[model samples]
Target: MPLDEDLLPEARKSYRYQWYVVAICMLAYVFSFVDRQILSLMIEPIKRDLHLSDTQFSLLNGLAFSLLYSVMGLPIAILADKRSRPLIISIGVAFWSLATAASGLAKNFVHLFLARIGVGVGEAALSPAAYSMFSDMFPKSKLGRAYGIYSLGSFIGGAAAFIIGGYVINLLKSVDAVTLPLLGEVRAWQLTFLIVGLPGIVLALLVFFTVRDPRRRGLRRDADGGVQKVALRHVIGFLWRHRRTFAAHYLGFSLYALVLLGMMAWTPAFYIRAFSLTSSEAGYLLGVVVLVANGSGVLFGGWLVDRLARRGHTDAAMRAGVIGALGMTVPVVAFTQVGQLWLSLALLAVAMFFASFPMPASTAAMQVLSPNQMRAQVSAIFLLISNLIGLALGTTLVALVTDRVFGDPKMVGSSLSIVYGLASVLTVLLLWRGCRHFRRSVAAERAVGEPAAQPEGVS
Candidate 1:
């Protein structure tokens, strides 16, 4: 029930040291995403070689990774809230990296599915723990920028998956396969998996050695001024009390995620199919858009939130979400309908810029709303729902439309347009309404204080 003085991040560390940790943690995040997303570029090859349909391939890309990735986040987050955060993250990086390498060994659909699940399980550890660490290490004023910088890894890793992975795919075209020392034979794509997946182990070691868990700041305390681990029921009650706030955040941003990640997952395939370009070409083009357009967009989203918060806007996150959704809707919808390649790419870049806002904004919203102890739990819950909607349902939405609605794989662009159009409208409406609820929730929390107990008869 007592606070641990040695666990305090501010006790002996300088701001520079704090930022160094953020950088390393961001690198780990980069590794996690590269392992998670490299599968996007290999979609056609994997589908062709494995003798699978679009829906089945979607299962491997979305369901297999996201189902466990989202679900396993909760227990891992609970452990993060109570244990050594960096050590937990380090183990996760290693586990997922090994899993990525193991994906090269897959001989069939089932083998690949299980390997993807392993990658998901390992990745489940990084964000929740990293978020918990960042919230503790940085002050509220600087939180958005810190998270924004950290969130940059998603695009950076994505770029690597495209640019570097593209180069590998291109270079391997002449060769049929490579034989390794222990593994007798491996496919070109399999070697790509091996190349991208193995470096994460070293990053894991860097995280474990250099980073230590900071003392729990902003802990929920009782009348006696003693700290206690929040019980499961209490966490539920707290969430229920702020139900509208969490609902908007979960659904609104999730719809945003559904569209954002859906684009990322399928856009490469769209280029390959629509323009008859190779995967490497599509990867190179999309990789640049992802790095420059989406990357800056997320950073600007974080800066926007911080600027709004500085200007006394409590609903900054929701406001930014709405703004981004509005900016993205038309371009995303029109991008897929365009016949000219240059025009389509331009619209897609515009769409990507606006699509990346919710990354940092959503995290900042939750971390600010929940107390320190409940941050990871709340984040895990959000991730579970968001990833399900974002990756699982989002990817499937496109594939399902292509398979069932259009009955043609070449119509993937049309399918992407339809999903993005619907998702964008829903996102704008939800987050617009969320701004009012978020403001009200911020007021109520301030009035009741951080450890607000569930008041009776609200249900």
Candidate 2:
């Protein structure tokens, strides 16, 4: 339903509050990515220090982190809905930050594994609560753009982590080269973790001070005279009723993640192997691409969706996502197959830009389709599936296949490419399904009766 123009005065006031919520959430998201991604930059150094194998490194990068993060994310997300989001997020930031710092002290695989798990546990507080909050803040028309801008935190933070982490690690190596006796030179990887981890302490404090809970009421009330509190059984019922919509969106999103996460997991190593770029150079270059391409793509996608939604076609923004899927797949397939460094980078940059374009629209779709009360649980389910199946398996599957099939480290790059190509096919198919069901979902939602929700923007 369209917002009443008479409500404009109240909405403008609430909009300011929404922006504040977005700002804090964005900071928390950046910290989350920084802490999580620091390990990727430190991969080579950690392997050298511990004499670890590629398979083990892949596990550290993929399974160890994803397993715990995926398992715990849903439960914590449910708690985020039930409790104070900012407080929960603040505690989470502290837990992950300290865990990341503790990684620097690890002497063996077991210790590092535990620390990674801790990071995952802490980082789990972010998406569900953040999503729920953002949904309350923004109206459906602006949700796409809001989610898009908010999603840029991943791009900005991920890029900065790579570039800053690379420079810091190089400096640490230089210090080690000089060999001061009293204050022992830290290893490149240890320095990377320490630097990345420290910022979260400050970010956590900001989250506590800045974010307030928007008193969100639901569109529908139950027998108890309040919004229905979503339970496991309720989630099951929701799925049963909306299975086709859920399946289509989930499949498309998972395929999208499969390609994206798989590439990100191994892209640094690929740059090292294929382009002969040092860790520092690869980190810096990739960081720039993430900032320039991914960042702008997110912002633009969000803005477009918001504008489009105002035209009385709410699903128009989602249609753009279908186009993005096809556009991204072409560049992605080409970039992977190419051998030249400059050409490959150009293609990859284009791919990243388009690949991220769907983020806001997809996230908005989930938010719009979900009831107010069930938003957090549903968001948790999305995270659980995406992380566990797509992220956990995408990289590891390729690495395992490459190891077994070719018995060479070099073959792993191609193996990564192949997995992405296969996933692209699924991306196109599922997105098509989602587009078909879009109007029906909106209609069904309206038939159930529209609630008088406050007009807020996504952060």
Candidate 3:
């Protein structure tokens, strides 16, 4: 897997600095998530204010963000490959933060859609760059934990969106509308956007100042020892060579993303409709669930990935993914079927725990399998596909199923169950096969690397 020789690896600084880099990346990720996810809790107000149907709202939720977000990742990731990652990430953080606040200024559906597009473009700068950095900073054996630690920002941001937004929204409920100095009158939800979105700029500054781009390690080289050209064509060629491994990795993890994101996007609506709880109440409860259940769940999954790999499980990442997908099937599908509130919540929490496993697993698989030059490009392509499938198609599918098939808003819970259940079955099958392909790919890559790793003229 170290196809790019780490024979001349970068000298690592103190462990604290390594963790510090991860910390900064994680913090930026948290702010990015908050800026995006705060919209979930403000759904009712936005729909009511904008006069949007469920489908239109779903379009705003999925396509508006994922469209440009998916498309732009390639170029941004390309930049990350050769450029300074911390600067790229800092620019992204500032841009998205402003975009999110700009969401508060949106007067109509088109306005909000445009603003969401901006958020998507900005967020595209993350992940690939961060993933590449993590691999360079830590050893392959520890990559899963590093990525998992970084990924907690998503859950933390999700929980923050709910907890913080819930309190602000609840407080604003007492007031019918807030009148900004120049923007005139708007609802609490509008102001809530400004409240949550603008703070990320500060975090952007922190990342810019504190996070240094680690020296790039494990570079692929030509037979004569010159650095190999890093171009889009090279990445394409590499993927073509390992088609089976990537196809399984991309599709399987994407389906898992579909299941996980589908639940996160719609669960608030489900809680509100099925349990007769207010938006604030749903936010508060989901906040706890996301933090306690999802937070701990991902950490455990990362730990398990490292454990399995240490035990000589070459396909440990994919194996872990299959286990997670299987574990979630019953809980996720059955949660909505239950009538009792407590039982439903319990099932929901359990599903969330297992649903989180695939993220770090996916990252570990990509970084460990590919050479360094290809990491960000390959990662960008996966993000493009994954977001389009998971966020765009998955969210839109749930909304369409609710609107067209069920023809009722209240059946959203059933729609979620139907979508998630099917996706779960599909994810398990793909990832189960993925384990074999991944093992073969790893073996093949190691064979090529062994001879390249020999001392000069040893042969």
Candidate 4:
């Protein structure tokens, strides 16, 4: 699936534009994370204000967001493939930004939960369109690198959310003595949500003005001014025929999500209880680890995968996922077992490094393996399963098991760690299985004379 040598010069030039796309997408992703996860840092204040429990916090973070987000992903992704992606992304950003701002007005769990759903609905447009755009922009040979850069946004954004969330909360707490006019003596949590949510508005405007819509090259407009060839049923049927491949990748990613989302959702609390770090300190340190370690892992993994693909190893990406899954388990174990804060932080960085490597590879593999038209829907389907199962159930189940079964704060983090370890093991197993079938399927696909899916919009 490598590009021809004659096209290499153009591909190199095209890669520059792909980096631009990455930069913009990364900014959008950062705002998304800031809005979504800033709530976690304020969990203590929110919980105390609302008289909620650990399980309720889990629902706020996981289910309320995932429920609508997961369900709406497919239809939105379908719209992205057929309509203007830049427009879709712009509208999504605006909607989510507004929702994040609205969260500041929430008076209770139900109001906040509804706002979270809005955030989820808005953010779901990003991955499908961004991934599709990457496929179109870059040549096939350069997609791994392009995707790697795009994937870095996730870590950078997530890390920023942690750091910024903590800082905003602490600042609000300190400034309680300085009362304001309309919103007098705002709690740390309320101010934290308000401050973090505001930046997304500017980001939404930037996306609207800067990104140009890429036209679908081969499509013909019907009398109604719609592209004639994109059929929803056809995409579903293609996935149905490739069930095993899809299932393997789905399970692999879901297991990865289960552990990853669970750990991230609880890690701040864990640091509070286990390491005695203030929320701000934990957030700052976590941000550094994510920005450096996880970000490098993403870029490196993409570079490695692209290099391997050039050498005629098509399964290199999946193999990277397998190796990353295995390596991640080590740090997961070390972080849970070790008591020292420095050691645990170091291991957490290592864990994030390995954990991030598979993201671009896995996402690229899914897109490459799918037919061009089905990319968004397939991505949506995977997101649906991964979010509903992993995000919704993963953290909630762990919290219930720890608080209800174990009956102690100290035991909660350790108990969740055990769940993470088991999930990591399962991720490796499923990815290994997927790797076995990937080469055969890819070869068969190429032999049948279907055009290899190219990197979209690299130029």
Superposition TM-score, candidate 1 onto the true structure: 0.95
Candidate 3 wrongly placed segments (more than 4 Å): 1-13, 450-459
The CA lDDT of each predicted structure is 0.88, 0.77, 0.88, 0.79
Clashing pairs in 4: 135-455, 135-456, 136-455, 136-456, 136-457, 137-456, 137-457, 137-458, 138-458
Model 1 RMSD in Å is 5.3
TM-score of each: 0.95, 0.92, 0.95, 0.91
lDDT of each residue in 1-459, candidate 2, tens digit only: 455788777767777778768877787787888877767776677888888877888777777777878888888877876788888888889889999988876778888888888888888888778888887776676677668878888888889888988788767765543323553555657656766897789988988887787777554688787666677788778766878887888778877877766666788887877777788898899899888988988887787777777777657656767777787887777775788888898998988887776667667777777777777778778777888767688878887877887788767667876778778878888878777677787777778865335464422
Candidate 3 residue-wise lDDT, 28-108, digit = tens = 888888887888787788999999988888888889989999999999999999999999999999999999999999999
Give the runs in model 2 whose Cα sits over 4 Å from its true position: 1-14, 175-186, 451-459
| Superposed model 4: Cα runs more than 4 Å off | 1-16, 176-185, 217-228, 455-459
**So what's the TM-score on candidate 3?**
0.95
